[model samples]
Target: MPSNPYADLPAERSWRRAVVATPPFALDPTRPGDFRLSRTERIATAGSCFAQHVARVLRESGYTFYVAEPPRLAGSEAEDNFSARYGNIYTTRQLVQLFDRAFGAFTPRLTAWERPDGRFVDPFRPRMEPDGFASPEAVAAARDRHLAQVRTLFETLDTLVFTLGLTEGWRDRHDGAALPLAPGVVGGTWDPAEYGFVNAGVAEMVGDVTRFVDGLRGVNPRARVILTVSPVPLAMTYAERHVLVANAYSKAALRVVADEVAAARPDVFYFPSYEIVTAPTTVGRYFSENLRAVTPAGVAHVMRCFMAHAQEGDRAATAALDIRSEAMRTSQVICDEELLDA
Candidate 1:
């Protein structure tokens, strides 16, 4: 036989044979990388709920997990796990819009959403304050303060880890700003004329995410990015097709786009948490009975892989950190998407 590249490849090529013959968690496919991390690096995490696990583990491991807007409310540390408290950023458009709003490049038209009791919430982050603010002025003041912190997060962090969650989202028709949740689902009134559904294709997501990373780098030239696709399926879909079919399409698109962007950018790298949890070898053990929430065991495995590949310094510094405690802290994570089921 000719001595081609395939002749020297590892057993993971024939790796599927073990999956077909053996049990779950047996065929690990995590690819090693040169994406190094030091204990001093200021790491920021965002994206779907799964990204919270990354931040939590980093914080608990004694790593510098950057937090620009620290929650002042008592008992809110666990809930405020991200670089900021922006809840599950599900789409690339939402991320870019966030950066734009932070820098005052974009201002959403639907500023405040009125509640039944006449109180108002920030339309961009309706759930940021669960009880709602006292008035429109209060909402505006709070949003401005939050945006200032988001600006700091973007400009100061050394590394940014973003998990691509969904391609489906709701956006404003006039301004093209992305909403975290649908207008009616959380606070604002639903107006078909004012709102539009968007299932961003590969090209759109790639463009938006690439622009975001490039913009971040422009402001902070030393920043590096790691992109991961959330293995958790969509909570719901607006597409006319069956939910299962829509989920497959959405996940597949995100996975492909993430790969492409990571490949195109020298500083951007892709991680395989999606594969670790969703692979057939795991036999669905990583998911909760609801099949959406990731199990603690699954989270630990993914983080283990990440730490193994990314962390290169002071490994012993975080070795004593308890994964159980980290898991407990993450259980308090607030995913805005779950409100869709409510």
Candidate 2:
């Protein structure tokens, strides 16, 4: 046999020799030359509930987890936990529409939804007001203010960490904007003719996200995006197929988009938190009993790997942060989709 270029490569490049051959604790999926974070970088998080974990880790590590709109409530509930109060942004179209609305380029047709008691909720973010706004005028005013803050988030942050949560979402037939949840699920009444389910394919995901990135960079040229897919499976699927089958399709499509988008842009990077938590190699120790929520151990392991490859100064600064007290706080994430379980 002739000696070829593959003769003397690092073991880390070979999955079998590096992962399967080594013990589970030794497995490290991240590679060198990946993007590194600086201690001063302003990182804004949006997307599914899983993104909340990233925000928490950033705060606890002494990194700048940019917050454009602080919560108005008091006590533990006050921490909305993301970069802003714009609840979970599950779809790329929703994120894009948010940018458009902030700049007054696009206005959704279904502005506010009314409840039986006559309270109104913004279609874009229903849960924002648990008791619901007093009227449609109030809903509009609140949404306008929220979008302004979201604009600040887009314009000021150095990095945006967005997690792709679902391929399926509900959208209005009129303006074609994505709604955070199906109308009836949270506040509004169900109007089958007015609302429809969307299972976005790879091309649509690519187009929507690409447009979102372009728009974001147009305002803030220095902003970069870090893409991630939520490893937690869907709480429920409206798709006619079995829940497991629908979930598989949803994740597969989103993962393809993640890979494609990251490859298309140099500034955009994909972090494999999804792979870390869901890989069969981990022996499924990362999931809770319900097999939906990620274990605290899993989150800690992921953050450790992320901080390891970060800038040296950032790593040292993060290490010196007061994490012991915050570590004692419970990890109870507020996910809208989890409502389906109820």
- CA lDDT scores, all candidates in order: 0.83, 0.81
Tens-digit lDDT track of model 2 for 53-170: 7887777677888999887574334255767777888888888888899989998888789877788988888776778989889898998888899889999999998999999999
lDDT of 2 at 100: 95
For each candidate in turn, give its C-alpha RMSD to the true structure in angstroms. Answer: 2.2, 2.4
Off by over 4 Å in 2: 1-6, 74-78, 312-331
Q: Would you estimate the TM-scores of all the predictions?
A: 0.93, 0.92
lDDT of 1 by residue, 154-237 (tens): 999999999999889999999888988898877889999999999989999999999998889888999999999998887888
* TM-score, cand. 2 vs. native: 0.92
Candidate 1: deviation at residue 16, Å?
4.0
